[model samples]
Target: MKTSIYATLAAVAFALPAMAQDMGDAANGEKEFRKCKACHMIQSPDGTDVVKGGKVGPNLYGIVGRKAGSQEGFKYSDALVKLGEAGEVWTTEDLAGYITDPNKYVEEKVGDPSLKTKMTFKMAKNQADVVAFLAQHSPDAGAASAGDAAEKPATN
Candidate 1:
């Protein structure tokens, strides 16, 4: 019985790191976001600049929990609009995938190979980090909060 208990404890210990990895490191993401400043910016609703950047892309203030291709005053590709219409809500997992490869992610989510996005820059690494930065600034990211997480029952 002791041996079985030890094995279970070891398994749980190892699993904890994996779970943390899924959450991403917001601090590291902020640093990595420097590269994205060439095209994107994180401006708040009050017009405060969270990250003063180029306006080539849409503002990413509340990217988390937001609908895809729904940025106001920004014209998105047909594919992105279709994604929004298809009910593509931005989750942390999906945002990581999208930043890794926008075209591929959209194609996978929308199921259209011919579709393309204006975002051509694909992050080779640290995709999770960048996503975490966006989530940090996302005030409406209710699921991203630790309080909300604490309220949820842990699942194996």
Candidate 2:
């Protein structure tokens, strides 16, 4: 019994770092976000600038837990609306895929090739990092949600 318990504890200890890496490093993500700042900004609801950038994309303050296409005052593409309708609550994995290729991700999820996003740039790499950064800014992303959500029950 003692051996089994030790093994389990050891496994969990090693797993924690791997899990955090899989979810992407939030610190690295912050640096990677400079690539996204040209179009997107992460600002608090109180109007504090998290990462001040252009207004081309909607504010991404709470996007990780936010419903897709639902950022206030921003008109979403039909495909994004469809994505939200399809029940996409942003996860880091999904968001990483999205930053890599918005149109393709949308098409894959919403199944509409014709609908395109105003976001034209496709990030060639570091998508996980950028997503991790975004996740941190999402206040609504609690214990049961966002980048670290997978680790929640495991840690408990």
Candidate 3:
């Protein structure tokens, strides 16, 4: 009985990391998202762009759970549209992988196998933190307030 109990405990221990990975902290993620601000801008409280830097990458307000390439008026590659059509919603892990290597992620999902993104910046360090930040703060993060939703269109 002791041996069986030990095995059960070991199994549970092994599964804990996987469970933890699913629950990323949105607040931490918001801080880490500073890296992405160079290319993308999140919405402000008054229903305007926060960064207002440039329109290099499309606004990434509601990217999580949103249909890929569905941001209105943004010119998305056919590959991205294909990714959206495949029902491949952006989860924490998906964002991590896409940031690490866009081409590999895009190709695996769509098969075009390109090595470039509309945004030329590469996120090498603290990618998990960035995803966490974006997942929590961005409109896509399912964290919209009444004021935010009142201004922005339905994204997710």
User: What would the per-residue lDDT of candidate 1 be over residues 24-100, giving only the tens digit for each residue?
Assistant: 77778889999899999999999999999998899999888789999999989998999899898887778889888
Give candidate 3's TM-score: 0.64
* Model 3 ranges off by over 4 Å: 1-31, 44-46, 114-116, 138-156
**Residue 88, candidate 2: alpha-carbon lDDT:** 88
* Top-scoring candidate (TM-score): 2
Tens-digit lDDT string for candidate 3 (17-115): 664444445555566667677767876547676445455666766565566777777787767777778777776567778887776788888777653
Worst 10 residues of 3 by lDDT: 147-156
List per-prediction Cα lDDT, in the order shown.
Answer: 0.82, 0.79, 0.63
TM-score-superior candidate, 1 or 3: 1
Clashing pairs in 3: 29-132, 29-133, 30-133, 62-140
User: What number of clashing residue pairs does each candidate have, in the order they appear?
Assistant: 0, 1, 4
| TM-score to native of every candidate shown | 0.81, 0.83, 0.64
